[model samples]
Target: MTLTIWIDDWQIQCCGESFAPGDVVSWKLLEVDPEDYADVVGSERAREIDCREEHHGQGEGQDPTPVEVVSVTEVHCRYGVPPGAADTMNCPVPGTTVLVPVDEADGWAKARPDVRFAGYLVTARQVRGGDSDDVSAAELPRSPS
Candidate 1:
């Protein structure tokens, strides 16, 4: 059976290998908890998108799940941190971030030796502090003339 997986940006940045569409990969999958990520992904989205984390460390006895990469999308999320609160809340945005697989009648007709599935990758980008109008050139130290 085909399954939708959520691969976080940090996982790829830390120790994930480069993968593209049509590439069959073996990954350690973990069941996602919708409530845990409801802040970033709205309650509805959290349930739709499955498989949140991929464990890189060794010692797990579970075998890696091999899957074919059907697509890859860069998910852009704009969030806001409430005053006095440390956690960020999701903002109302058009379109859903969840990657739902398209059903193909003949896609899995032939069964392979191993159970292979089709999935997509979602990568998110976050921007932090930077130069702003509040900080003027005069505030910075002068360079040698």
Candidate 2:
């Protein structure tokens, strides 16, 4: 059976309505002012939502947590994306923003064994702290003055 994880933090919302033992809330309330992620939620995030009539995805290898699109860049044009991922996402071209699995980009090639193209190394963004987004990842050499 496909297990559904109760995703807490990064959900960006909470719920006021009470439900029976396993009722799907569908709509949860969040503390964040709606404006904070208005653009994301309205566009990309909305599409990210699964639209099957079942409401719950029972498919193989489905992820339960919510992930935010931090930014989209060519897999090679941008560093930090893991190795072994295909040059397609890494090559200089625009593509759909990918939602990463909770464990980070460790399973790209292993999980998608069927796909030969090197894929992207997706990471969980909503859970990370400050400066992880803004700082450059480059390492500078130390110099003696």
Candidate 3:
């Protein structure tokens, strides 16, 4: 399934690896609380993925989840607004309260290279453990030698 994962700037600065589009990655993700991230994710989007229980990583633990990087976008939170009413934009702006991305790439040459932005937007597929073709093959009936 295609999923958008949020990675915070602090999390990146603390412990993050550089990545780009088309890169497959593994990360530990947690469910995104719609009410908590409504301002950044928008109400509609939050609800859309609510049932699916969208996941995100806080740059903790060794990544074990698999996902693919599709695109990277910087989330700019405007200034001089309510605590959680700041407008979010994909493009750069002046005096942003906070900056983050749906996807993350350390040392990106384009747009604010000096400044580290937010997180990453990744496409993740749901794969149940011990359910791969290899596992099935091993379970096949054995033929007498």
For every model shown, what is its TM-score relative to the native structure?
0.52, 0.17, 0.51
User: How would you encode candidate 2's per-residue C-alpha lDDT over 1-145 as one tens digit per residue?
Assistant: 1111122211212222222222322321112222222222234343332221112223223332232433221112112333576553432222322333332222122322222222222212222232222211121111112
Which parts of model 2 are misplaced by more than 4 Å?
1-63, 76-117, 127-145
The prediction achieving the highest TM-score against the true structure is 1
Write the number of the candidate with greater lDDT, choosing between 2 and 3: 3
- Among all windows of 10 consecutive residues in model 1, the one with the lowest summed lDDT is 124-133
lDDT of residue 82 for candidate 3: 47
Compose the digit string of candidate 1's lDDT tens values, residues 17-110.
7666666666665655545445445566556554543656532665565556655544334334455666677342333334333332122222
Show the colliding residue pairs in model 2. Answer: 13-29, 13-30, 14-29, 14-30, 75-89, 75-90, 76-90, 85-118, 86-118, 86-119
Which residue pairs in model 3 clash with each other?
75-100, 100-118, 101-119, 102-120, 102-121, 103-119, 103-120, 103-121, 104-119, 104-120
lDDT of 3 at 68: 58
- Model 1 ranges off by over 4 Å: 57-59, 84-145
| Candidate 3 lDDT trough over 10 residues, lowest sum | 132-141
> What does each candidate score in C-alpha RMSD?
19.9, 18.0, 12.1
**Full-model lDDT, candidate 3:** 0.45
